[model samples]
Target: MSKHPLLVRDVLKRKHFESAKLIAGQQGLNRQVLWTHILEIKDFDTLINGGELILTTGVGLQLERETQIAYLENLIRNGAAALCIEIGDYFNYVPAELVAMANAHDFPIIIFEEVVRFIDITQDLHTYIINQHQQALTQLDTISRTFMELSLMPNGILKILQVLHQDTDALFLFVSEDTKSFYYPIEAKKYLHLMEDHCQQLELHEPIQLMSIDKDHFVIIPVNGLGQVWGYLCMRSALPKPSDYTLLNLERATMSIAQILMRNRMLQERQQSREDEFILALIQGEPIDLQYYQSYLPMESRNLFYRVVVFNMLDYANTFSEEDWQEIQLQNVMFVRSIIKKLGFFPTVSVRQHEIIILAFYIAADDMEENRDSFNQAIQQIVARKTPQLFEQITLTFGISNVYQSINSVQQGYKEAKTTIQMQHNELASSIYYKDLGVYRLLLHQDHVALLQYVKDYLQEILLIDQKNGNDLYQTLCVYLACNGAKNDTAEQLFIVRQTLYKRIERLENILGADFLQAPHRLNIEIAVKAYELLKKTAPDILRF
Candidate 1:
C-alpha cells in the first residue's frame, strides 16, 4: 500500500472541498498537507507551521493591495501549504496581484464559488491526516516486528537486507568496516566499487546522507554499535527523493543490522574471554580437565599436532595511548585469526599486553614432513598478509614453537616459542620457528655469567688486541670460523684480498696457538663466537671484561 503523505490534490477530492476552485499555483497541487487550520486574524506568524492548509473568509484580506500581498507572503514564508478562502463575505474576490504572486511562488490559493463551512473542511482533512498517521505507525510497527523476527534466523543479516529490498524495491548494500560489501539480488554487486569509494569519504559518526550518484539517489545510513560505527546501510533508487515512509523503513533496517552486529560482538567477546583463560592455563602449565580441553580444542584424535605461535608488536606501546594500543592489539588478533582460519587451521587466540598468542591445531597427515611444511607455509602467508591497510607503521615479529602431540607438552611448546622470539637475531626475517634457531637455542639457555666466561676463554685475546689497536682481528676470526677455515671463502666474505686474510690469520695464530682450528678447539671457538653475538644483542654490558 502507498504510504505517501496527503497532498493538496488529495484534499480537493473531499466533499467539503467539492465547491472549491483552484485560483492559482497549479504547480503546487502536489504540496503535502500535514494539517488544516482556519485563520480569521490578520496576524498568523505563529499560527502557521509548515505544511498546514489555511482556510478563512476574506476578512483578513480586506486591506490595501500591499497589505494583502504582505499577508499572503507571510503565509507562504511560514510554509502554509495552501490558502482556501470563502469569497462571499468580507471581500468579493482575491486581487489580481495576489493571484499572480501565488502562482509565481507556487503557493496554492483556493476560492469557493459557493459557500462552504470552514469547520467541516477542517474536520474532514484533520481526520484524514490523523488516520494516515495512525496507518503509518501501524505499518512501522509491523515492519519492526518482521525485522526482529528475521534477526533470529541463521542468515539473519542477509534476510534483513532482503526485507528492506522487498519493501523499497531498491538496491540495498551493506559495507562492513573492513570494506567488505554485501548486496541483495546479487546483481547489486555492480555498485561495490562505487559504494566503497563513497564510504571512504564518510566520517564514522556522521548521520544519514542523501547523495546522487550517476543520476540515481542513494540514502546512506551508518550502522552503529559498541560505541562506534560498524558499517553502513545504503539504499539506491531512481526516485529524486525518498518518501518519508521509505526513510522510516531504512532507519528500522539499520537498527536491526546494528542489533545483529552488537549481538555477534558480545558473543565473540565472551568466547574470546574463555579462550584467553584456557591459553593462559596451558602456557602456565596448569592442569586442565579433559572435558574443558575437548570443548576448547580441536582434538579429533591424539595424533594431531599442536603448536604455539607468538606475535610481538614492535615499538607500538610508546606511540599510541593505552586505549589505542589495546584497540590495535584487538585488530591484529582478528587479522591473525582470519588468515589462520583461511588456511584451514583451527586457531585459539589470546592477547596479552603487547603480545598475541595463538594455539594452532593441525591434523597429522601420513607424511609428517609435508604436514610441517604446509604449516610453515601457512605462517609465511599470515606474515605476508599482515594488516598493512589498518596499521602501516606497525611491525610484527612472529615466533613458532616446535610441534607437540600431547596436550601436556603444550607448556613446553609455549616456552620454545617465547625463546625463539627472545633469542631471535635475524633482522630481515619477521617469522622464526623454534627448530630453525640452530646453535642459538643452546646458547639461549646458558647462564649469562657462564656464557660471558666461555666467550672470554676463546676470544678474549683477539677482542682486547682489536679494541686496543682498532684492528680487524676479532671480525676476521669470526668470518674464518664461519667459513670453516677456508682462506679464500673467508677473505671473500670479509671483503678483503687473500693476502690481507693471510696476514690477519697469521696474527690470530700468533696470539693463540697453531692448533686453535683443530677439532675440539674449533668447536669450542665456534660456540664461543655464537655466544658472544647473542650477548652483544641481548646483554652487551655483561660481555665487558
Candidate 2:
C-alpha cells in the first residue's frame, strides 16, 4: 500500500485552522500537503521540499511589491503546497500583487486574521497527516485484495472498469492500440473521445505518467504483454490528483488487465487452432460428419449452402518485415472477424500464410436469388467499408466461389476461389467471383499439365524476354486475346495509346514467331495464354519450369 497526504481542504476542517481565511488560490484547496513547515527566513525555498505548506508571519516577505511577487513565485516554483501568512504580526494586509500572483498560479494562500501560534498549527497538522497516511494504508490493502479477487473472476474488461468506477466514482476507458475504438462502461460511452484524447497523451508521455484534462486528473497505464503494448487503460478522477493508494490500484489493475488479455489470447489461439483444423478438413475434401464439427459451425452454416471468400493480402510480401508481417496478418485477422460480426454474419475466419479464408454460409430463403444477392452484397459491403482502414499501401484481392450444397464440395469451391484470385487483372476491382472466370475453367481439364507445358513452350521466348526487360509482353498478349485481338480495344483496355500497343504487338510477334497473330496461330496464342494463366493460378510451382 502506498502513502497519501492530506489536502488543504482537509486542513481547513481542523479545529486549529478555523480562524484561517483563504484569501487566494481558492482553486488549489485540494492540493495535498505532505507536511507543514514553519519558516520565517527569506531563503526558505532552498531549505524546504515539495508538497510542504509554508507557515510564517510574512516577516521576510514584506518588501517591494516586485520582491514580494518574486518571493511568492519562488515558493510556487519550489512546489510549496500553500502559503499561510499571519496578517496581525506582519504588514496590515497581504500585498495585492502577491494575492494576484497566488490566485493566478492557483498557489493556495491563507490569511490568519488572529495571531495563531505557528508551532501549534504545525504540530496538529503533522499528527493529522500521519493518521491519514496510516488510514490510507489500511484502505490500500483492502483495495489490493479486492482487485485480486476481481482479476481472478471470469469477468472481462467491463467488470474491471466497473470495480474501478465504484472505487473512484470516475469514468474509466480502455483504448486499444489502433485508437479507432475503445471500451467503456455503457454509462460512460458518452466520454469516448475524452478517453481517446487521454490515450494520445499517454502515448506522448512516458508510460505511467500522470496527466489531467479539464478539472480531472488521470493516470494512463499501458497494458503491456510479451514485450509489446496491447492497449492502455485510463482512470480519470476529479480528485485534483489521485491518492498514492489509488495510483497503486491503477498499477495493479494494469497488471490484471494484461493477465486477462494474455489469457484471452491463449484461449483464442487454442480455439483458432481447432477452427483451422476444421477449415483444412473442409478445404481438403475430407468427409465431414455434421455432428462432429457442429459446435464449431455457426448456425447459418448448418445444413446450408456455403461458399468461400479468399482475401489475399496483395502488399503483404513487400510492405512489412517477416516479424512485423506476421503480427500485421494476425491483427488483420482479428479485425476482419470483428467487422464480420458487426455486419451480422457469423463468419468462420481462418488465416493462411498470406490469405484469410472466410466461409460464408447461405441459408435457403423463400427466394434463392435474393439470398444469393444478400450474400454477395455482404462481401461487397465488407470490401467497401474495410478497404480504406487497412495498411495505407495495402490492397486486398477477394476471390469468391459459387455456392455448393454439400460441405464436401467446398474443396472445389476453395480451388475456384483461389483460381478467381489469380485471374485478377490490372483493373480496380477488389472482388471477383469464380463464375466470372468461366473461360479460364476450360483450360483446367485432364490435360492441364501437358496443355500448361505446351503453352509455356509456346510463349517461353516472350515470357523470358519480358522478364529480362521488366516488360509486360506476356500480359499484353493475354489482354490482346481477351480483347479478341482488336488492337484499339486492347490498347484502350491496357490504358496505353495505340502506338504503344502496336509496338508491344510487334515485339510479341518477333519473339513468338512471325505467324503469332495469324488466325490459326492466333487461336493457339489465345489458348496458350489462357492455359498459362490457369497453370499459374492452380499450380504456381509449375511456372518455375
Candidate 3:
C-alpha cells in the first residue's frame, strides 16, 4: 500500500492546501519535492511521490488549452488524488474545457474557496492523515490470515484476488497479455477488452502503479512482484476525497503480501509442470530416478519388471482438457497398483494420458510366469474400479515383457506388454500380456529401437503392397501367444480343430520363417511374434486429446 498524505480532503477544504504539487508552488519557487506516490501533476511528466501538496495559481491554467490539458493530463495520468485550482487566479471558476475532460476522465478536481493559503490546509490536514494511516495498518494481521485462507495456497496468485475481493470488497481478475482470465474471483470476470478506453489511467504505463477506477471511485492496484504482473487489484468504496496518507499508506500495506503471493504461485506452478514433464519423459523412453517417484520405488526388490499399458482412447477429439484425461489415467493406474499389491506383487505406477505404465519390482524372473495371471486379474479389477460402469466400449489391454534382471529392461517390458495387447483379436481388447501374442507378432523378438522401426516399416509394407489379409495373421498370433505355444492348446484355444490350425501355422512359418514350426525355430519365432504384437498394439494407436 502506498503512503498517501494525511488529511488531504481537509487540507483542500482549508484556504490553502499542502500536497506535493501545491507545495511546489504555482510557478517557479525552487523547493525539493517530497511525496512520491502521487505521480499525477499538471504536465508533470516525472514519476510521482504520494505525500505533500501541489499548489498552483492560475498560471498553469492560463496556458493554452492544450498546455492546460497536458498539465491536468499529467496530474491525473500520474494518479494525483485531488487537483486543487485556486479561484483567485485567471478566473474564479474551473475552466469549462478542463472540467469537461476531468469529468469525463473522472480525475478528482477540487477547487478551494481561495480565501486562505494552500499551506494552511496542509498543516491542518497532516495530523488527521497520520492517525488514519496507523489504524489501517493495525488491521494488517487479520488481512494476512484472511488472505491466506481464501487464496489458493498452491497458486500464490490467489492471494491477490483474495485481498481484492474479500478484504477490499472489489471483484478481481488476473489477466494475461491476451486479456483473458488467467484467474478470477468472479465468474463473470471480464477480459480487458476496454483497457484503452476505461482503465488506462490506473495503468502505471510503467511496470507497476495504483490508479483509481474511473469516476475516481475505486483503486485498481497492480499485483506485480518479481518484475512480473501476477494480476490486478480492484478496491471499492473509495472516499469522496481521501487524504494522501490514506491512498499511499493503503497501497504500501497491501503491496508486500501481494508480491510474495505472486512469487510463490509462480514457483508452485513451475514445480508441478516440471514434475509432469519428468513423468512423461519416463513413460516415453526408459524410467529413471525421477525425484517424485524415487522414494516410492519398491524397497528390497531383487528383480524388477514392468508392464506397459497404453490405453487406446477412443474419441480423442471429444475431450477438451488434458487435465481431465490425465486425472483419469492417474486414478486407473492407482487402482491397478492397489489390486496388484493386494495380490502380493509390488506395483509402482507411472502414467500419462492414453498410456498407463506400471513397474513391478521384487518379483524374480522365475516367478513372472507364475504371477502373470494375478497380474492380469489385478489389471482387470483396476478397469472395473476406475472407469465408469457404462464405458463398456473402453478396453484395457496390457503388454507384459519377459522379466528382465535389470530395471533398464523397462523398454523391453513396455514392448512386451504392448505386444500382448496388439495380438489380441478384439476391437476393444483390455488387460492383456505380451506372452499372449503370436506369430505375425515380431515385436517381442526385437529391442526397443528395432521393434519400433519394424512396426513402422510393416505399416508401410501394408500401405505399399495394399494387402488386406492380416485378419488371419492377427487371429493366429493371438491364439498362439494366448495358449503359450503348445500346438494342441493353441489349436484347441482358437476352437478351429487341429488341422486348420496346423495349416494356418504352416502359412505363418512360411512368411515369418521356415524353421518356425521346429523347437529352436519356434522359440525365436515366439520372441519376434511377441515383440511385433506389443509394438503393433502400443505404438500404432496413441494420440493427443
Candidate 4:
C-alpha cells in the first residue's frame, strides 16, 4: 500500500474548504496536515505542536497590528502547518504585513471568502486523517506479516531488503558485522562505498536518524538483535525528508530484518555448538570415524589437505571484563570465519575461551608448495589489513600448523599450532607458522623438564651471574653468539664499545668455559638460548633458576 500523510493541498479539496482561497504561502501547500485545531485565542504558545492545521476566525486578528503580527509569528514559530482564517466576519482581510510574513516563512494562510463553521472544517479534516491513519496501520500490519513470512526463508535478509525497496523505491543496503555489505536493486551497488563511509562516521549506538550525503538523503536504521547490533540498514531516497508513513514502514521492515538475523544466529549457534563438540573431540584425540562424520566436515573428500590455525587473544582477561571478553571472542570467531571463507578455504572453526581454533581444508593440488605460498600470503594479508581494524588495543597472535593429508592427524596439527604460538618470543611477529619456527621446531616438541634442564646446563652460570648482578652478561653472550663470534658486530648490536664487549666476553668465558663458541658447543649454546626464550614464554615457572 502507498501510505502518505494528508497534505495541505488535500485539505483544500474538502467540502468545508471548497470556497477557501490560499491567499499566501503557495510553497507551503505540500505541508503535512496531521490534525486540525480551532484556536481563537491570541496566545498559541503551547497549543501548537507542529503539523496541526489551525482553523480560526479573525477574532484574534481584530487586535492591534502588532498583536496580529505576533499571533501569526507565534503560529509559525510553534510549527503550525497552516492558518485558515474567516475573512468576512471578524476581519475584512488578512493584514498585509501578516500575509507578507506568512509568505516569507512558507506558513500557509487560507482565507474563507464566505462564513463557515470552524467545527465543520475541523470535523471533516480530522475524520479523514484519523481514517487515513487507521488504514495505514492496517496496511502496515499486512506488510509486517509479509516480512515475518520472509524471515523463514534461507535468503530472508536479502528478501526483506527487496520487499522494502519495492515498497519505497529507495536504495536499501545492509552491512553486516563481518563487513559484508548487501545491496538491493543491484543498481544500488554503486552507493555501497558512500553508505559505508557515512556508517563509519556515525556513532552506531545512537538512535536511528536521517542523514544527508552528497545531496542525497538516507535513513540509517540499526538492525539490533540478541542484545547487540547485527548490522545497519541504510535506505537512500531522493526526497528531502521521508514522510512519517515511510519512516514507519522502514521501522517495521528493520524489525523484521532483526528477526531474520536473530533467527540465522540462533540456527548458526546450534550448528556451531555441534561442530565445536566434534572439533573438540578431534583436537582432544578422541577416536572418530571420519566416514561417518563426513557430512559434518567442511569437505568430504579424503584427498583434501588439512591445517589447523589457533588465534590467541593476548592479555584479554586482564584487559576486559568477562562479559566483554566473551563478546570479543564471539566477534573474533565470526570475523576469522569470514576471512577464511574469503580466502576460498572451508574453515571449520571452534572457540574455546580465549582461543579460536580453525581447521582449514583445501583440495590437494599438484603444486603443494604454491598452495602453501598462497595460503601464507592470505594469512599475511589478514594480519596486515584486518587485524588492526578489529583489534586496536588488543593483541592477537596466530599460530599455523603444517598441512596433513589425513583428518586423523588433526590432533597433531592442533598441538603444533598451539606450540608455534607458545614458542614465539617476539611480540612483533604476531603470525607464525610451524614450518618457519626453525630450531624451535625441534625444541618445542621436547618435554618442558628436558628443555629446562638443557637451558640450565648451558647457561646456568651466566643466568645466575646476571640475576645476581643485574648485568648484561647473558644478553651480551646471546648477541655475541648471534653475531657468529664477531666481536665488532656483537658490540654494535649491544650498543657497547669493543673494550666493554671484551670485558663481558672475558666474564662469559670464565663462567661458560673458553671453548663455548667452538663447534658443537656453539650449536648447543644457540639451541639453549632458543630453548630458554621459548620456555620463558611458554613455561616461565620452569625457569626458576
Candidate 5:
C-alpha cells in the first residue's frame, strides 16, 4: 500500500506553524491552527464528522469550569484526535477540571499563537488518511478470514478460542456461573468444576463466575440462543476494564460463533432424543397391547415404559429465562444418561426437569425393588457433587415410579411418582423413592372420621360463641389465626379489631382446654389448620366447619 499514514505523532506534527504568540497563558488554552476565523469550535458530541482537528479563537468563548469540562467530555466520546485551543485569542489557561478530564480521557489538546492557515496544516494529510484506511481494511480482512475459517469447522468453539488466544494472547475457557464471586478458571482443566457450577447457575440468566484459577481479569460472553443463554465463553486478559466499544466488537463477532456452537449442540441433543424415542418405540413394537397403557393408568398411550425419578432443582421456573430452561433440559438429559451409563443402567430412558415423564423404563416390575438402592445412590451422588443449588435447596425430593411390564404401565408409575413428589415436599433438599415416599400415610392421616371429629369439634366451639352472639366466629378465627399466631399478622390479615379476635380466642380457648391457650399452644392449631388445607377437598362438607 502506498503510504501516507498518519502516526499519532504525525497527526500533531503536520501543518505549517507560523511564529508562535501567546493568547490565554493564564487560562491554559493551546491553539494548533489559526483559521481565517474561528468559525465553529463545537465539542466532540455535536461534531458529527470525523477527521476534523478543530481550532478556535481563545477570545470570549466563555470557558467556565463546567463548560470546559463538557467540551473535553464531548471530545473524548466523539474521538477527537487532539484538542487544539487557539490560546492567542482569549483564554490563556485551562481549568483544573478541564485539564483533569482531558488527561483522564487522553485527548491531547495543543496551543498556538500566530495566525496559521487551516488548509496548510491539514489538507495534504489525505494521503496519510488513505493509508490509514487501507491498513484498517487489511486488518478487517484478516479477522474476517480467520472468522470464516474457524466458523466452517465442526469444533468451532475450541477452534475459535484457540484462534483468539493465539492472536489476542491469553487463555480461554467458557465462563463459570458464580455471579457474586465472579470466578473464572481459564483452560479446560476446570471443565468438571465448571460443569458442576454451570448446572447450579442454570436457573439464573445473569452471568456467573468461578474461582480465579490463574489470577487474570475475566469476562464472560454469553452463548445465547433460542432466547436463553445456553452457555458462556469466558476469556482472561490483562485489561481489567476493556472499553465497551471493544467488548461490543468482541460480542458482535462472537454472536455467530456462539450461535454455531449452540445450534450444533442442540441439533445433536434433539437428534439423540428422537433416536432414543425411536429405539424405545422399536423395542415396544407397533402392535402394542394398548389396553395395558390406557385403562388402568392415568397417562396410557405410551408404547415404551420409562420409570421416572424426579428431582426438583433448588430453583423455581420463574428464576430461569426461557433460554436457561431449554439449556437445563439439554443438560439434564445429558447428565442423567451419563450417570445411568456409569452406574451400569445401560439403555435406560431418562427425562430431565419438570417432565410429565422421567424414568428408567421397561425393566420388569420385579426388578424395581432391586434397583432401588443403586438409583437412590446415584441420586445422592447427584445431590452431593452437583454445584450449589442444583436441586432446590428447599427439598431434594426424588420420586421413583414403580416399574410396569408394559410400556402402558409407565402411567401408573408416573402418577405414583408425581404423588410422591408432592407428598415428600417436606423433605426438600433431599431425595425420596416413590415406593418409599409412601403417600398411603396421607390418606390414613387424613381419614374421613378423623377429619369429621376435628371439624365437628371446631364447629361446636364456633356455634357456642355464635349462639352467645351472632358473630361469624368460625370464619373470623380461621382468617385471624391463619396468621400463624403472630397476633399482629393475624389482625392485619383479617383487617379487623385485634381486641375482638383476642376476645374470641379467649372465649374459645376455655372450651378447648387450658393447654390450647398459650403462645406455643397455637402451633398445633396452626398445624391442624394447614393440614386442613390439604384435607379440605376430601372432607368438602366439613370445610364449612
Candidate 6:
C-alpha cells in the first residue's frame, strides 16, 4: 500500500538535508512536507502555500529581533511546514528570540551548520513530493475500486466505514438526520455529546471542521444522497489537521456512500412498490398468491404470531401539498422499516391512503397473556418512541392490533387497528392497541346511526343550548368531564377564570336538569361527548349532512 507524503523528520533523513539540525519545535517533527521552496526576501511569507518547507539564508531574518520574530510568526501563520536557516550566512547561530517563538508555537526551526545549495534541496524535495503524489493517486484508485465492491455488499456503507477507520487510524462515524443516534462504529456512543454541537452544520451539506472541548479536530463530509443530504462521514484524529491524502480518501469514501445510498433507495423503491401492492391487497381482504408475497411478508408468520399497526401522521397531512406528501410517505415507509427491523422481527411496511401500514411477526407465544409485557415494552420503546419524532413537522399516532396465529387474520387485525385509530381521534397519546381499547372496539362495530343517536340523546340539550345561546357550553362540558369535574382544573384547561367556569357549570346543571351531575348521568355524558368527537373526526362531512 502507498503511504502519505514525507514529514519534516523524513526530509531530515535525506543526504541533501544531512547538515540540517533541529534547533526548536521538536514536537512538530511530524509535520507533513508537501513541497519545498527557497526564500531570498523578507516578504516571502506571502509566497508560500500551506505545508511547504521554506529554506533561506536568514535573508528574511536580517532585521530587529522583534521584527524577525514577527516574520517567523507570519510564516507559521501562513502554514509553512517548517523553516530551515543557514546559520553561518546570518549570525553564525540561530537567534534565541526566534528559537523561543518557534518552540512556543510548535513551529519547527532547522539550522544548517554547513552551507547547502538551495537549488539542490528544492529539486530533490519537489521530485519526492511529485513521486508521493503519484503514489497517492495509485492508492486512491485501489481504494475507489475496493469501496465500489463494498458498496455492492450488504451494509456496504458500514463496511466502508470499518475499512476507513482502520486506514485513516481515526474515529469514523455516520450520523443520521436525527443526530440523536449513530449509524456506524457502534462504539461511537461515547462521543455523542461531543458530536451534537456539529449536527446543524452537518445538514448544510458543506464540508466543515469542528473542534471538541477535548481539543480533538473533526472533519465532517456530508453524504449527499438523492438530491438531499442523508447523513455525514465524520473523521476525528489526533493530528492537528488532516493531511490532503486523508481528505482525498474521505471524499472517495463519501462518493461510495452516496452510490450505495442511491442504489439502496432504488432497490427500496422497487421493493416498496411490490410490498405496497401485497399489503394493500392483504388489508383490503383481496386474494394473493402466498408464493409471490413470500419476500415481503415473513415466512416466520406461518408458524409464529403477527400483528398489524396503522400509523397516521396527524397535523402534517394538512400542511404539505399532495405531491410533497407523497414523497414524504415513501421516505417515511423506509424509515419506519428501519426502526421495526431493530425490534427483532420481520416487518412488511407500506403506505396506503396517506397512512403507514405495517405487519410485523412476533415470537410464538403460548398465550396472549404470556407475551403481552415484552411485546408492549417493544411497542413503547421501539415503535412508539422512535416513530413520532422521526420526521420534522410530523407527529405519528399508532393503532396496534393483538397478536394472532395465522397470517390470514391480518385483515381482521388491520381493520381493528384502523378502527382503533378512529377511537384515538388524534389524541396526545402515541398509540392505542385494540386490546387496550375495550368498549370502543365494540362501539366501532356497532351501527353508526345507533352510536350517533346515543350521543345525541345525552348531548342534544347541551348542543342546542350552546348553538341557540351563542355559548361554548358543549366544549366546556367536554373539558369539565376530561378534568374529572375539578372546577379549577377545568378553568385552567379552558383558559378561563374560576368564576366564569362556575357560572357555566351552573347553567349546564339547570339546562340539562338539576340531576344531570348525578350518578350514571356523568358517565353517559362522558361517553356521548367522546362519541361525538370521534364522529366529527372520522367523518366530519358526513356529520355536516
TM-score of 3: 0.32
> Residue pairs in steric clash, candidate 2?
none
Task: Tell me the lDDT of candidate 1.
Answer: 0.80
**In order, what is each prediction's RMSD in angstroms?**
12.9, 10.0, 19.5, 9.3, 12.9, 9.3
Clashes of 6: 0
TM-scores of the models, in the order given? 0.55, 0.51, 0.32, 0.55, 0.44, 0.60
> After best superposition, candidate 6 residue 459: deviation in angstroms?
2.2
Better of 1 and 6 by TM-score: 6
Tell me the TM-score of model 5: 0.44
lDDT for 38 in candidate 2 is 82
Please write out the lDDT profile of model 2 over residues 1-545, one tens digit for every residue. Answer: 23545788888888878988999999998787889888777776568888899988878777777777777888899999999888865757887788888899998998888888888888898887778778877876777677667777876566778877777777788787432344455756766777676665554436676676677676777876544466788776676567777777777777877777766764574468767778888899787677877776666444466678788876566666887766666656665665555444556778877788987764664346224565566656556545333433567777888876666777888998887887774332234877766556666554766876787778888888788888988888888877777888999889999999989988877777777778888877777776776666566677754
lDDT of 1 by residue, 11-30 (tens): 88888887789999999998
lDDT of 6: 0.74
Off by over 4 Å in 1: 1-159, 167-266, 369-372, 387-392, 425-431
Worst 10-residue lDDT window, candidate 6: 381-390
Leading candidate by TM-score: 6
Poorly placed runs, candidate 3 (over 4 Å): 1-279, 286-293, 303-306, 309-311, 315-323, 362-370, 383-393, 425-431, 441-545
Instruction: List, residue by residue over 398-511, the lDDT tens digit for candidate 3.
Output: 566565545555666676666565555443334365554445444335566666554443233322232454346556755775676688988776778888887776766556
Candidate 3 vs candidate 4: which has greater lDDT? 4
Candidates' C-alpha lDDT: 0.80, 0.73, 0.50, 0.80, 0.52, 0.74
Give lDDT tens digits, candidate 6, residues 72-184. 88888899899998987574767788888899988899988888888898988888888888888888889889999998898787788888877877878776653234434
**Candidate 2 worst ten-residue window by lDDT:** 384-393
Which 10-residue window of candidate 1 scores lowest in summed lDDT?
Answer: 422-431
Q: Candidate 4 or 5, higher lDDT?
A: 4
Better of 1 and 2 by lDDT: 1
lDDT of 5 by residue, 415-518 (tens): 66666676655432123555564334344356676765654554556655676788766666677565545777777676777797788667666765556635
